[model samples]
Target: MKTEAVRLYGKKDLRLEEFELPPIKEDEILAKVICDSICMSSYKAATQGTDHKRIPDDVAENPIIIGHEFAGELVEVGAKWAGEFKVGDKFSIQPALNYADGPVGILSAPGYSYQYIGGDATYVIIPKEVMELGCLLPYKGEGFYPASLSEPLSCVIGAMHANYHTTPGSYVHKMEIVDGGKMAILAGVGPMGLAAINYALNREDRKPSLLVVTDIDQGRLDRAASLYSVDFAKSKGIDLRYVNTGAMDNVAADLKAITDGYGYDDVFVFAPVVPIIEQADEILAFDGCLNFFAGPGDSNFKAPLNFYKVHYEFTHLVGTSGGNMDDMKEALEMMSKGLDPAGLVTHIGGLDAVIDTTLRLPEIPGGKKLIYNHIRMPLTPISEFEEKGKTNPLFTELHEICQLHNGLWNLEAENLILEKWNKLT
Candidate 1:
């Protein structure tokens, strides 16, 4: 089979190429990728190339695929797993494959270490290890975009699950955020931060009674409030508040004042900035668990913490990078049960736009940049669909469809774009 994909050759060296894929072995499966959501991790991999731990040292000789957050359909099933999975099964992959003999040992993942199995390709050969490790997940969601986005939602789900609280003088730690307790997300309103907000509001198992999302950008906070409305959050029995910390003189003090100086039980830091970390630390209640959700680019990143609180007050800290298989399954299950993650996607593009979009992801001002693998369109923001509709018929229909759903991307819009652009390919 022949596949088109964006491959990383070296530092900031990415190429869009069409190459012949080897025949799938009996233990392997053939898949046709539908869509991939561009992640900052892919941008880091593209820029750092071999320097990234998940990237192989021999990328110059053997380039790897450049996407991970993706979902697709099965075209052919290998004989070794015909009974377990059949052709035409919609699926999403949990990319964190902790296999010992992979290209990068336990750090190996689908989008980073593999040559023919990344999410950027139109077609891919799923290796036996993916099946053996059970990372191949069957997604019964309505559209491909939600399944692709489940990977990111799983990350926040894992972060929430990883948070813990403690009892007085007890050595054991209680898992998950404190239910019906006060919570805060510092520097929230970005793409991942929005995902955290969505999950925190809609979670059926456990949730915070008081949810406060903070951001320096008023525009972003306003956008988040519009998408996940205060009325909607109140309907779910949550007191949701969007606060712009840029306008405050003392962010920690202002946040604590919201809880009547009782402080917060669970605080999540969404930005890598030092002040945000310190602000999160300063506003913790007793037995508060501060989850550092952001990953810093610098290796020597440091932030000040109150050792006095850590010792006497039992303040806790934890960090999470990505989700495991159970977390991905939970995300997919939630989406199937009508948890919409459309709020995170801000732009849409096609296979032809993957190279530039992946390389300049950080420079782009938006949420997820969703890429349809079989199309040939440039990266265009959904917010501009109405403006672009003046000259383009495709954008006209897209604008009309988006208007029906409050200007957010939906399954109808996704299907229309695929139908319109797939013919061009």
Candidate 2:
């Protein structure tokens, strides 16, 4: 058997490569790669080559697959894993795993050494370890449920769970409110910012009195215009929802305006640019929080610190980088509940579309663009555990477990054995 994969050969160059299939181990299942989204990490890797910050320094750039944000189904399941997960189960990709099995295990040993597998392919062999880390998603139809959004959403989940301040026993911030409170979003209204926006809006026991979104791009401001649904943008005023200063004038004035001249209570610096954080320093209220949502590893990525402002004004600083398995699970839970991952997905493409779509990250500002339907059209759709049980036995198990525990697992069927026939003469 063979598989087609989008392999990057050098800086800025990508190609579709074919590889021989490997035998699936008892704890491993074969997955047909279906959906994936282009990301800034992949784009920067192409532009910066091995200089890419997201890919670890020790890893080889070329001859590697390209996608990280994706979702897929189990096509083949190994027998030892038969009771572990079922076929036809769908889930978002949770790419991080920590192998602690004495460091000599075959399952994640190669991945730990080779820097993990990428998703720009026609097929992927899912070791039991990787499957255990994925999030099982809730579905509503034969249509792809957009579970491919797990990776980006997981990043939001991490930020939400990070350093939350509170009464010592409360969630993140013990204050228990945001969105409807005075909130400042720097470089806001882009897809990434939108995720933060919605998450802040929908936070339980934490309602923001005001939601202040800022962007120099008129287009982004225009898009932020629509976040006032019942579940998002709970603030009573749409006039205060978005603001545009074109990255030139003082954004402090706009944020101050939303906060009734007092400054916002919470500020989210969604863009990685230095100047934006500077402005966040200006308009954040005393004891307010400023979160650095964007991350850049450029040599010149340093931002001038206003330590005086941070200390005197009592502003809180926080940031989150990548998605982990636990974060992915939280994201899937929100998606399962019918919450929009906040229009953060701006583009959707197939495995063949990686290079083209990746190149557009800086230009495209918001939304977590999707890739499932484009790459995995040949896949049989699955919505019910009972449905998957007819063909692959693992479906019922994975589905029941997901519904009951709000988690995801990989379902597959595989045979990894080398049986000796009659003695050779």
Candidate 3:
């Protein structure tokens, strides 16, 4: 039926739109989306996108659905998978389906191909294959507040378990992941950077001798220090020293001042900002590691990374993108252990605020920005759009079209609107 979605229209226009949904197939589960966290990547989607990452041609032509991070509960299940779920089952969905065949990776098993699913909608249909691979997180009600955080944390897990992090963890030849002994979080304080910082503190191995998180933004730097738990040990009083890489000098010197005139052991660059990397390599200690955390566009963006430093210092450079199922499990495991996962869900609002929220996503003064979808829901597609926890609505012609449409809206149990529309059409 009718689902409220945040649609991307070309370069710089994103808005909330009403749309129809296909009925859940035999291998599908209808998820009633309750909460979704707008990631930093979602905020910068258009800016970072080139022709390659553009939405598929068929989806919207102009305004295709755009949200990809979300958490919700299963409301409907196909007969074959009925035993796997029950009503009121709370769950957080892993929306990145990059390695697949279908729009939502329904038909194709996951791989490195089709990467995303539209999450800013009233309902999301999970393919049977996704559920089959343990993608559907069953509700255990174990302090999982701010379930919106699962996706972000999952990405961290993906990075940690990758060849880069794991290689260091093996301890075979002194290679170890979670190099906490003298670690630094470059551009730390932003939402994604903050996530990296939190993940680092939780790791048992590689606890940093000096946990240095730097950011040019004073506000975010303040936010990072206020975390209290992660920085209680070695972080200086969270003062940001702005570096003008345009000067092309003193960048390494500044970092030296922070690290006892020796470069840091490891650095995690949260964004793909090039100049930061120019200076990052110079300041890293011999045998240091640099982890590029954010996912940049596919247009071959260039940076002045020093391969000489990479070779002579015995250093390494690595990057990570969206999280996998293992990452989701790592996030859920943190929740189960009673850690405050809700720190990630910093901002919360509703559908009526979608435009406002999206406009502010890039500048918001918080960590995890979440959109509560059930609020300000329109009644345009009554038959298909009606949900169990949805708010009551006032009907108009548009609302009527949304609600009464039998073809899309009255998906589950038929309603009056569906019957009337079906007979007329």
Top candidate on lDDT is 1
TM-score of each: 0.99, 0.74, 0.74
Predicted structure 1: lDDT: 0.93
For model 2, residues 35-153, the per-residue Cα lDDT tens digits are 56556666766566555534433344425566766666778789976775678876555655554441223222221222224666667776666656443333332223346655676
Q: Residue pairs in steric clash, candidate 1?
A: none
Error of 1 at 367 (Å): 0.6
Residues 262-331 of candidate 1: C-alpha lDDT, one tens digit per residue: 9999999988999999999999999999999999878899999998999988999999999999999999
**Best of the candidates, TM-score:** 1
Model 3 CA lDDT for position 424: 31
* Candidate 3 vs. true structure, TM-score: 0.74
Per-residue lDDT tens digits for candidate 3, residues 1-425, read 56777766544566666767678888787777765666666656533332324344343353455565666778778887888787668887665544355543332222111222355667766666567667777645442234667677778656655524223334343444544446666676677766766776665544555676677666656545555344344353222232323343576687767777777766777767887776677777776767778666545877877788665556777777777776787777776665445445444455666656665565656566556566653212122233422443322332454334322211121122223322432
Candidate achieving higher TM-score, 1 or 3: 1
Which of candidates 1 and 3 reaches a greater lDDT?
A: 1
Positional deviation of 94 in candidate 1, in angstroms? 0.2
Candidate 1: which stretches are off by over 4 Å?
Answer: none
- Rank list by TM-score: 1, 2, 3
